[model samples]
Target: MQNSKLLILSSVWVEPKSSAAGGRMLQLIKFFQSIGYSIVYASTASESEFAFDLNALGIESHVVQLNDSSFDGFVSEVQPNIVLFDRFMLEEQFGWRVVQNCPDAIRILDTEDLHCLRNARKGAYKKGVLFQNEMLFTDVAKREIASIFRCDLTLMISEFEMALLENLFKVDRGLLYYLPILIENETIGKFDRRLSFSQRKDFVFIGNFLHEPNWNCVQILKNEIWPELRKCLPDANMLIYGAYPSQKILQLHNPKERFFIKGRAESAEDVIENARVLLAPIRFGAGIKGKLLEAMVYGTPTVTTAIGAEAMYGNLPWNGFIADDNQAFVASAVVLYSEEEVWKNVQQNGFEMVKERFAEHSYLYDLQTKIGYLNANLKSHRQQNFIGMLLQHHTMQSTHYMSKWIEEKNKK
Candidate 1:
């Protein structure tokens, strides 16, 4: 059979080197391509200097407009076999149009992480309270869950989030697909290319500064974690690396105190491989962190909080010690940095976790099987998902008219 066409509506162009979401988007695109899908990526956001060159990868790119009729014409022309929304927001904007224009196309929502979960945790953190499920019932949750119900399948990045949707929100399992960040089988052999524990030096933290969690983490490191850690390991240096560091982030640099803020790593993996240990005192975030995953890939051990290591390891020990307590977190970092045996063991553990939890081949096969099965029995599947049908029907009428109203107003 000839391959089907896949269309992705993104909030921003993929920038793999700049952010974790970008990396995940690129991975998803490449996976579809590898499975013989003709891919086209469309977004409303302007292209940035750091955005990945989708055209260079032989994928067609289009700049779409929100609340416009032009998108209807584009969707009608493309008539994709599958439509994947990058996040719930995009799904909310264009999902109705897709349903109206190409009703047969299998609509999928890729929830990069549970935005509601992350937002709830962040809110609770700011309030100095524990995050509760009740906190998740926000306006964001309403829109995100509605998007999930409207789509044939929603890709979940974390197993934790999948369970939350099933048990807490009571979303059907068939509607949600658990597909974590996958590591290729070939990466297992690349461990040989990594620098040995002794060759690596200093503690490092890398993330996109634009992300609130990362910015909060850097503050926590500066105010709460680093002072204690520096006092303990006076000779040890902490280097912060990330893209688009704001002035506030840059101001944290103090060469006299052995804390250097190195903005924007040229190659995250290269810098990670050279680091003795990765320190991420992430206070609040969702999804698997790309930095933590990169550390494992580069054979670098890490010392992070329970929140930092959440849902990352399944039935296996962490690549390094996980401690939420600042003092203990500092102590773990000291040990991981000083002891070669401990660091080496943790590094090996990381490789094992990557192999077992994130093996690319297993996930690829699972995705292919799921897509093939859905394609063959989409009608029956849709019949079983009456709620999705209802939501789509209602969304079509409500969102459709509102979008058209805005489109008409823009012409005046």
Candidate 2:
């Protein structure tokens, strides 16, 4: 693997503080760097004020174009050993181009989370209906699943989603890899440094407001949860924190009611650590919740919905309480805030869950071994994945022409 290069195609530049996706992207970049792979991050998306400076980290950054031959030239010149699509959308947009230009490069799709599952849940929530399995068989699923099959391997962040792919969709196990968020070794030691139950106060909800689910969660808290919680503990405050707060979100802030909208937390950890209880009533979403994970790391007990806690804690006891009922949710938060012994015990449960489920050591070595093996046996690997090759051949024929047509149209 000497002189190996890993080219990452992102839809957005990394902004760790802005969202969990940004933080996850940075983690993957660092992982590639640690394994001695020269990295280049290319994106069609424009850079933001808060975007992480790739150049500062000794990683090359490129702004590439869509539906253009310029990307073909870029990929050919870079000649990356590995081409990683940041999400399935990137895969759908550029997967064919990469296959056509760089046949030898290992194609991997880093599915941030299953977008179809998220969208399906969103639709169900909006309709006030139970999410059905048939919902997963939509247009989004077709594109996403096809992208999974087209790639050599797809990285899944959640085990639940991984099972859904194999058991329901019949995606080959070899074509999917489970790669959860890697917690740092130093993070465990920081658990001792967290504020005691007495030092911390109130309930806190932190998430990226741009996420539809988060905005929905904040609305639920304001309209449904908080009013009931306040009735129980009239003095307790519920601090709503997140990045990219719009006018609509800001309007929800009422200082008299102590429902503070503290936009853009300077440090998610700092805020979570200082808070007595983290309350995230995420109604419907996919993958693991990063805020809940951070709460565990910071020793802040959380009271979240079943959907918020989904696929995170496994069979282990939750860090705090999991309640879907608004009344139960608020009751759990009030108790978690008021009782020291219960809160401390819940905090310890979080610590154990973090150590057991999310530690880097659990996955890093296995990932390295799998990648090395896959790289060594590329020819045979592709041969075994005949369906992928067939899909690539046929799907690309249509996609290839459409892209070329778009390129020509743009030239005129």
Candidate 3:
């Protein structure tokens, strides 16, 4: 018997070694392959160095152009049994066509993060203010919600978001599935505390500067948190690592400030494992913090804000300190840096948390079972989702016409 055909629509290229999202997507594909699925990965973005080698994975890859009729034919010819959208925006763009041509296929949306929440928080940050209730009613929410409605199911990474969809949005429980960050298990012996203490130095923070939240958090530290930290812990170095650092970010680097922009780390694990303590004083951000998770996997404890610590610990005791206020954040960093016993305990806590929650012992099996069960009953599942059907119907009518219009325009 032939394996099930699965088509993945992507917002960006998948390159595990390059980015958090790309790496996650690469894992998903591998998981699917492990479960006997023939994959077809498509993306609207053009190829880049970070793009995954789909050929090596034995998965068919295609470049898709937005607002073009060619995508309609692409789906018709491929006729996959399952279609996974990488993020909310990709769903909004290509969702209807998938429904139009491959109505029988199960449409799944992979929301990397709640864009609505992130955008709302960004708006609040831009105004130098707090998030307002009115922000939820903005356009992003509508598009995001509509995208969810259009899909058979959505893969939510954060448990906090799963609750928001249920309590706040009244989203149907059937429409959302909780799928936390997946990791490969490496139950390596805990790092030697003495060796860790002797090798560790400086306060470290790393994130992709392309993300608004990281840029904002770094600014907060430079202007507010780091200055105070330096006052208390004199002679301490605060080295920063991130990809796509802007000219604006470059301006913040200063030896006198004790804040050095070391650029992107050659290996995320190396920089994090070597750090004395990870420092993130985030005012507002959504989803699980990858830096903190990496810190945990690396046996490094961090001091971050409540938002940074959200949904990550999973009732497992945090591996390190969680502080919201600037002064408190500084104080925690100081204590954690100096007290070897305290630091050692947190490191052990981190290693244990990673092993228990994300050690990938059950990740593959659970994902395979749930996905296989859904696949077995895919038709009935779609029939039960009336909203998905309705959204698919209209998406076909409107987006289909607009795409034809663009294709015609392009010929001229």
Candidate 4:
């Protein structure tokens, strides 16, 4: 029998070393490959220097243009059995083309995180008010939720967001699938080989700086968290690492204050493994944190806020500590860094979290089974999702004309 074809419409080329979303995309590619799918990855975004080479993995890579009917012919020729959108925005942009060209293709949207939820929280944080579900009713929410309703299945990274969608947004439970940041079993096994507390030094914070939440976390560390933290542990250094550090982020580096902004690590695993403690006091964001999971893989304990640890551990004890207040966060960091026994225990918790929650073996089979069932009953599935059908019909019509108009305008 011929292997099935899967076409992925990505907003950006995969850059696993640069961002968690990139890593998640890579994981999804591997999962589909393991299920005997011949994959074709196409993106409208230009390739970055750090982008992973999908062709190296035997996956076909194509550069696709937005608002162009050329994509219709391209997708029709590929005729993928499954068409996965990297994020909701991609679905909104290219979904209609895919639908008009290949109606039988099972469309899947990977909601890397709930952008609506994250944006709502960011807006609330900016206003110095606690985030409420009512805050979620934004223009972005309308577009994102509509994108969700237009797809056959949407992969949700956080269980909290999944419940929020079902309860707050009134989305059907059948449309959402829970798939967290998956770690390879072999990677989990390397936890024992990570540096011990005595061998490691300094406090580390790593993320992609282009992300607002990460940039905000860095500011919190500099102004609110680090001054107090440095006084508590004067000898230890605070190292910040991330990709695309703007001038403002670079200016935050002060060797005199022991707060150094080291832009982008060569290897996330290497730096994370060497650090005694990873600190991320994320005030607002959605989705499971990739850096925190990387910490678990490297046996590096962390001190993060409740938002950073949300839906990550389930009922399992966190790898280190979750503190919302600056004082409490500093206190946890000092104790975790100072006590070897406590650090070791927390490190063990990380290993356990990896083995139990994120190991690919636990989720991959279920994902495959779900995909198989959806493929077999695609027509009935679409029939049952009335909202999805309605949104697909109406939204795609509007989006289709808008795209064609843009394409014509561009020609002039």
Candidate 5:
């Protein structure tokens, strides 16, 4: 009943020091392995920069190169009962191969976020235009949805995306399951109201700058929003903190403007928890923003846009405020940052929300049970996904031949 062997094909190696997805995968691996499931992690990323030593965990590791025939052979040899694709991109790349070679294997796609939605929203924000449905019909949509349909099931990370997929793409509700960031119900000690916030100055914005939406938000704050906010709190500063900030992002730095770009944080938790208010005026993006979740966890209430706060607050009252228009967003940020009573209420609300939605006891237990059931019933589960089999039949003939052609070409 326990010791189920699982093969997890990741987009990158589980590098806790570098990757969020990698760290999440490691947690899942730990959970499964604890329950006696043997795990084999395979990825295309190089062995270096993989912070966690695979040998220590006793999980088998395989280095898979893209556009190669060797993968089919390797997968056929392993014959795992369940295959976990780290993200939709990985699923798009090797999903068909797994389905073709191991027809009975349960294919699970952990859609880190809806790529099509992210891509579309990014495109619109950069152009200073609004999102249009016609843009959704692009090639990414075809590939993204095809991967969703090809897999037996997909792990939906954001409730907003779950509804978007079902309503917009018409994906079967049965194929999508809610699986938010599963975190241990660790205590986020009482907010040190004296030093952390009362003494703190300025509005703070934090995110991974490599992400398009974050970079877009930086520009919005600098060119448009901050000037308005400073008018209200002229003595206050706005500190922008994030990881992997590019030179271009650093150039946004201006002492006179008081928009400080302090690069990557030594500790993400420390930066946000110490801030007076978290400001994320994200125009459009998909999935729940990790920074916002981190803010909530740190009890740092935020002032964000509709897109930034989407699906997270839900019917429950928001930790702080949601504003989209330029003037409204700036007004909300000033109020959240300066008003101690309002800030305290928002912070407490955030603490409750994280505890309610992301606590391990609520989502993880049920998810583990589902994963066990699916793994145990792999054969019958695949039978229900006839479209997966149909796709497998054709992809074996088409993609198999195409991969072979490329593999043969590489020899010359």
Candidate 6:
């Protein structure tokens, strides 16, 4: 039997150290490689200094162009058995081309999170109104949902989002798959060696500042949470760390205030493991947070909002406290920071949560089974998805011609 070829169409090159999305993509890539698949990664986005070296892993990396017919020829050449779109936007850009070139290939969409949900919550937060499910009805939602319907299967990071799509949008359950970010058993074993609560000092907040929610979160930490928190614990410092820190973010750093803005940790695990408590006062966002999960792996308990803790922890207790109000958030951080016994207990909860929720064994096996089933019954699967077929037809006609026009315009 020939080794199956898998092509990944990514919006950006993976930079696992920079963001959770990058780490999640690396996890997926390693999983497919383990299953003995030959992988090819293609992206239109420019590579950064931090981008992962796919060539080092023996994976072919290609620089693809938008609205270019050359992708049609490239897809035909690779002729992969599976084509994974890194996100809905990637699916929208290259999905039609894949269908025309490799009709037999299984199409999978990995939704890092529901962009529509995040956008709606952000809109509500900006307007100072409570976010409602009704707010989810936007043009972005329409585009994202259409991309979901067009794919054979979609990997959802949040269980809450899976339920939302099925109940609210009435999307067929067969098209959605729950696959959160997975942690290897080897990484999970390092929890015992992490620094004890006493050995660690200061509260740390780390994220990719390019993400709007992270920037918003930092502002909340600076203006609302940190001010009260510092007053309570006069000696303790608030350390902010992330990638792509803008001038505005840099200006927030003040030695007199004991609030430091550190840019780009070379090792996120090292920074997180040494922190006494992780602070993420996320007012609005979607999906299970990568930062929270990383804190768990490193035995660093966190105090975050309900929005930050959403769809994480499942029925399990949070690693630390979940507080929405600024006062409550400050109080929780203080308590988690001061009480040694409470800190130790919550740290254990984090370890257990990681073992139960993110163990890679079950998810990887299930993924294999899903792909096998889809490979054998692909024709029947497509037949059962009438909405998908309809959308594919219309999307192909519209996107196809529009792309052709863009390609012609670029020449002129």
* Cα-based TM-score, every candidate: 0.98, 0.98, 0.93, 0.98, 0.91, 0.99
Q: lDDT tens digits, residues 182-212, model 6? A: 9998988887888998899999999999999
For candidate 4, write residues 51-126 as lDDT tens digits: 9988899999999999999998899999999999988889998898888999999999999899999999999999
lDDT of 1 by residue, 62-124 (tens): 999999999989999999999999999999999999988999999999998999999999999
For each candidate, the alpha-carbon lDDT, in order, equals: 0.90, 0.90, 0.81, 0.92, 0.79, 0.94
What residue runs in model 3 are displaced by over 4 Å at the alpha carbon? 132-134, 187-195
lDDT of 5 at 153: 82
Which is better, 1 or 5, measured by lDDT?
A: 1
Best by lDDT: 6
Candidate 3 lDDT for residue 78: 93
Reference-based lDDT, residue 331, model 3:
89
Candidate scoring better on lDDT of 1 and 3: 1
- The C-alpha RMSD of each candidate to the native structure, in angstroms, is 1.1, 1.0, 2.1, 1.1, 2.5, 0.9
- List the pairs of residues colliding in candidate 1: none
Query: lDDT (0-100) at residue 398 of candidate 4?
Result: 88
- What digit string (tens of lDDT, one per residue) describes model 3 on residues 142-174? 889888988878988888888887887778888
> Which regions in candidate 2 have their CA more than 4 angstroms from the true location?
none
lDDT of 5 at 405: 85
- For candidate 2, what's the RMSD? 1.0
What is the RMSD of candidate 1?
1.1
Candidate 5 lDDT by residue in tens digits, 1-412: 3656789887566755343454467767887787777889898887765357887989889889888868989999888877988877888678778877887787888887888888888788778797887778778987788788888789887998888888888888877889776556545444344244576666788776667788889998999999888888888888998767899999999999889999877677677777878888888788777788878887788988888887787667788999888988888888888788998888888877877787767876777778777767767776776776676567668877787788889989
Residues 112-194 of candidate 2 have per-residue lDDT tens digits of 78999999999999999998988999999999998999999999989999999999999999999998777888888777778
Candidate 4 clash pair list: none
For model 6, what is the error of residue 118's alpha carbon versus the real structure, in angstroms, after optimal superposition? 0.5
